[model samples]
Target: MLKDFKPTLFILARFILIYLILLAIYQYFLNYYSGTGLDPYSKMITEQVRYIQNYLGYQTQLYNDIKNEQVYFYVRNDYPTRMVEGCNAISVMILFIAFVFAFYKGLKIFTFIIISLILLYILNLLRITGLNIIMTDYKEYGKIAHDFIFPSIIYGGVVILWLIWIKHFVLKDKVSNELKDKI
Candidate 1:
């Protein structure tokens, strides 16, 4: 019975350990940029969003709100969205990275983690851009779009990536071990 639960306990422990370590690092990062009113991550994300929106032919402007530590996104002179630390998606990336490392199989997993993080980052950029466009063009739907639709898209992307990693890495290793035991 003890043996039966050992693997489950180990996995849980690993997950929690990795999650806490990564979260601590993230908190430290936020603290380091707290009073400065200039978070590099948020700034980079805002710039990317601006580039993306401009490339899509939507004339946009960015205003740094130093007091609030946020960047507002203006579309055609209307402030429709703001980019903050949360909007930058580093938290989401941290969570994803924690999960991937918790189930670490080999060094090759690093490559997969990097690729997945890049995809997730791109997905988040698109989500923010789309949300800004929708909010600017459709004010009445802004609440639902921000509160429901955009969250679903970014989180759903994370779930899909997790499933892919589990299927290709974790479960594959487990199945191989089981086959070896049978042989």
Candidate 2:
């Protein structure tokens, strides 16, 4: 009875460890940057998205909103949409890191993670840019695009990256051996 629970417990422990560490890092950034004169990372994300939008000849306007004397970032491409903290992709990246770390600890995990995160950040930028473009170009589909498709691109890419990590880096021999022992 206890033996069967071991594998589940191992998985849970790995997941929790990864999650807490990543969450701590995320929370640190959130708190450290919250009450400052500026949030450098959030501004970077907003600027990157705006640069891409501008490169594609979509004029964008960026401004800050202050509530309780704390600054919030926002961008507009015709219609205004606030880029409020969550839109910056840090949370999604944190979740991605946690998920990737949970599954396998094969050699080069950090290498793969760093490269994957860079790619994911680019994809997230594209997702942000695409959503704004959709708002401008495909007005009729704007709701569904915002609510469904663009997010799917970022999250779906995470799933694909997870699969790639498992298939390419993690050894089949080790996995099968673990499976054999667990079973």
TM-score of every model? 0.95, 0.82
Q: What C-alpha lDDT do the candidate models reach, one value each?
A: 0.90, 0.74
lDDT of 2 by residue, 1-183 (tens): 989999768867887898888889888877786765336776677788878888888877666554432232233425535466766677778877777677666667789889999998899888878877877777788789888998888889888988887786655656788999998
Instruction: For residue 92, give model 2's deviation from the true position in Å.
Output: 2.0
Estimate, for each residue in 1-183, the C-alpha lDDT of model 1 and write its tens digit.
889999888888898899899899889988988887759987988899899999998998899998899999989989998988888888888888888888889997899998998999899999999999998899899999999999999999999999999998899999999999999
| Top model number, TM-score | 1
Q: In candidate 1, residue 166 scores what lDDT?
A: 96
